[model samples]
Target: MNKLLSYISLSAIVLLTAGCSDDEPKSEHKGLTGYVIEANYEKKALLVAESDKTAKVGNYDAEWYSLNDDAILHDSKNNTVLLTDIEVGSEVETWSTSRSFESYPSKTDLSKLVVADDVKHPDSPMLQKKAIQAALSHAKSISDTAAILIVQNVTTSKSEWIIQVFNSYSEKSYEFTVNAVTGEVKQIK
Candidate 1:
């Protein structure tokens, strides 16, 4: 009787330990869906706004999310994509760390990013990458040490990119307005 009871207790303990083991598969992490209002390719970060609030209009309340070094990036089809491939105005879902810094635009670390299939402004001729290149090129012509300070899509009746570049040598910032359709860059400031 003692032997049988000891065997039963050992089996129960083993079963309980197995049930609570870390080897169990974890459930998929939940993600937040937002619109990519701004893409800082240089920094590998994005400013995203809640899709429900800023789908078709402004991004006044966007938050900044820096992509982790090991962050998984894929499209809706699950095809792997580079960070530069993500464009502004695209809808994306992100999985991020729990911690975020409190600031004007709260910042967080992103672990995964997926570009949604149903992007609203996919037909735009001038993508954000092209617009940034154009703005940077124009900025370099004026100052060799020019770096992008801000890139914003100012689409109204017509699509436009307002790129702000800072010149370290001159200690001044210049805003360039690039025509999103024609890629014409003009110094607005």
Candidate 2:
């Protein structure tokens, strides 16, 4: 009888071990989802921490990314700002695709950054001031742009301006064009 009992106990132990091991390996092979690693903003882009998966715009989520590398970001006006200072090996939430990763700030908040002038341009304060003065030099031009504040994007082609403005004349938002560069604002009739 004792021998039979020992045999039963051994079988139970083997079964438990086998079950646990099988579950463990399965989990190991599973992929991680929606994981965000911290990244830094640099050179007008985001430098993700540690891994090469620099910050970028994901099709799913949008959030602020911190910079870890010495890399910095520059605005169109040439304003420079420190992107990251996270300690080595430490990572923060970053945006990356399963296949590829990027290290540039998504053009999400560009409108907020746009102003009469950029004070953060890399040029000297005096020079930056001068540039701002020039950017605002076209007072009427700026006002014209402001009137169509719902513009989606601004594209310049040589001496011509191709402005993408949001047309709200209807219930849905539609994109329209204008010539901002020439100081001649044309709208779709």
Per-candidate Cα lDDT values, in order, are 0.66, 0.30
Best by lDDT: 1
- Where does candidate 2 stray beyond 4 Å? 1-149, 167-182
What tens digits encode model 2's per-residue C-alpha lDDT throughout 42-85? 43332221211332322222233322233233434556533342
Summed backbone clashes in each candidate are 0, 23
**What local lDDT score does residue 137 receive in model 2, on the 0 to 100 scale?**
31
Give all TM-scores, in the order shown. Answer: 0.46, 0.22
Report the Cα lDDT for residue 65, model 1: 82
Best by TM-score: 1
lDDT of 1 by residue, 69-131 (tens): 778999999999999888765667888754667774568888888987642224466665566
- For candidate 2, the lDDT comes to 0.30
